[model samples]
Target: MKPSGSLLKIISEDLMPVTEIDIRALAEIYAEENVYLSVYLPVSRENEHVNRVFVNSRVGAIKKVLPADLRPEFEKTFDMAEELLFEPAVSGERGRIIFASAPDSFLHVYRLAVEPEKSLVLDTSPFLLPLARLRADYEDYGMLLVDSREARFVCIRSDIAEEKKHLSTDLMKKHKKGGWSQMRFNHLRKEAIKSFFSEVVENVQGTCDELQTRGLVIAGPGEAKQELMDLLSQDVRQSVLGVIDVAMDISRDELVEESDSVLHENELSTSKKKADELKNAILKGGLAVAGVEDVRNALEQARVNVLLIVKGSSVPGWICERCQNLQANTRPPEQCDRCGGPTSSVNIVEELYELAQRTGAEVEFIEQRDFLDSDDAVGALLRY
Candidate 1:
């Protein structure tokens, strides 16, 4: 029997791979942790991307497969593993397996991701092509923030969301006394919002043109966003999905959490609101509507792109004489796989197990400890 999704995972025991790989051709490979595992799967989406996607910033070495001459050794590596391969709906010259890991089944979910850049530059997109075409590929959508004194735009992967302004910052840089200082800082904030949006128009619009999508978000603090809406070309504004009301101190990190907190209060960044919705859905057993039955159906159809289940909820299906919670089955014929208990006395009832059984899914269980604490993990993405 295939192991539960909980059994397969990948964790970076070497957290400094970025710096190490960038500085050295290949950093010393570390032994895999007991909790970590990795896989390769077919690629989807774009066939062209940047070469530097996964090279640690310091090592500067892009991920490259064994040269053509090394095919003999490469095939040997695959033969050594207990493996299975599924082609699914791949249409490109290459395919990719998504490598994800969870700590103890759920606490921290690790996605195969390209590191974010500090500049409003979408440098990572160009790097995904070769990487995905090779074995050590890591590509996934992400967000970017573009700012100018007059506008601000938040590009989520490709779709563009913007906020622009003509707020007068020209008035405040003079006095550090009294209300004047407070007034000046507010003006700087307002001007920054405007400039951010202008850059968004130049960046996100140029990237997603070929992709058919809409409802991109535009957000940030102050009246600049309202001003940006007024300035968008009719063609651009029509694609906007939401404008939130939130603000944050400038951030150095480009992850969604840092930028999102500021925009959560605005009418532009809806990350928080959508996160709440997904959480509500998951809690309502929406994720396990048919439990294993639904999963079985999905597996048969090969429609399961991602399958998630809460961890530690796994239990055998034996009727325990002491507690009548679960009906017992196979009273004594089989051996227990996990606890070595008599198979007849225990019953299996993990929500994920049933889900996995039904779906033939490559599973990833989030241990209670690894559960994503934020909505970003499950939030419905808004695109424009």
Candidate 2:
């Protein structure tokens, strides 16, 4: 599975009172692009109770969270009278455990005003996708058993001895005594590389094997990676989700970074393979239809994965030829409260319903701006 979030970590904010949670300041939380959840509470929270909500699960996802009481009430807003099912708290009964996809804190604030209903909605963001993206970590951790020229392995459950070198002749002297070579430097280099890998693999394996759940492993900036990856089995080598390409002195710190780093890259899909599919579909043209007729036909068969119809910002009223009924409001009319037919001139939404019902499939109707995407150009997830 791909990493569903970019920056996944926990952060806390304290609001002493309304004096502290300014709408302007709280607004900043929305800036976080991949904020899966934001738990807020007042600054002087004295409640001893702990409350935990599951943001993720192996089965699938929980679409929303209800108060200890009822489902979410979308119409409520700040400075309003209604008691929202659950207002964003500075702290939950439990410490705020956030699962996010970005590194910034401002996103925690910005999301409040931007969402139609942030609470009880569970974790449903079109942007937040499946967990399969992170499966690469399986390959990354596989490096533990790799063998190489430098394999004087050590198995330590924990504990790393820290040694600081002045980077002077003293350091060189120690190297020389170990046959680290002022003369057979090649052999010395080989041993040094081996030692580093042994230390790394033991440490890596210890942490990885101990984990109750899959954790992120970050490796870079040292021969430990080079030596280990080289010696690792082919299958293990491919397990790495990424190589930071930068060096670091400590593997532990890198592990945290890797764990928190989110993969923003999304894989291409059949939906996205727009240009090629359109080219093929056109070449294999069928019973020729265009305009409303073509769109209607595709809808009738539930063959449209996505339908892009040409319409303007607003739809005008239509007068039915049979009943002489005039379409009313653009939003949603009284449903022809008269003849019990459609009161408003049905727009793409009405057609969409018809199309979906005809074929037993449902898809998104992205705005025209979204159409510019090659995948959205024209293709339907045909209904069988």
Give the per-residue lDDT digits (tens) of candidate 1, residues 144-213. 2322343333333211122222222333346555654666688876665556555555554654353333
Over 4 Å off in model 2, which ranges? 1-219, 222-224, 249-262, 265-384
**TM-score of model 1 (CA atoms):** 0.31
Report lDDT (CA) for all predictions. Answer: 0.33, 0.31
Please state the error at residue 99 of candidate 2 in Å. Answer: 15
Where does the lowest 10-residue lDDT sum fall in candidate 1?
Answer: 118-127
lDDT tens readout by residue for model 2, 1-384? 112233222233431111122222222122211222333321113422222122123112322322332122211211121122123443212222122222222122211111111121222111111111111111122112222222222121111111211111111224435554455776665676566565655555444455322222234444545666665445444444444444333364343334334221211222244334444554577322223444455665556654432212223333232232433234435445556543223333333333443354433322233433322222343433
Residue 347's lDDT within candidate 2 is 34
Alpha carbon deviation, residue 358, candidate 2 (Å): 20
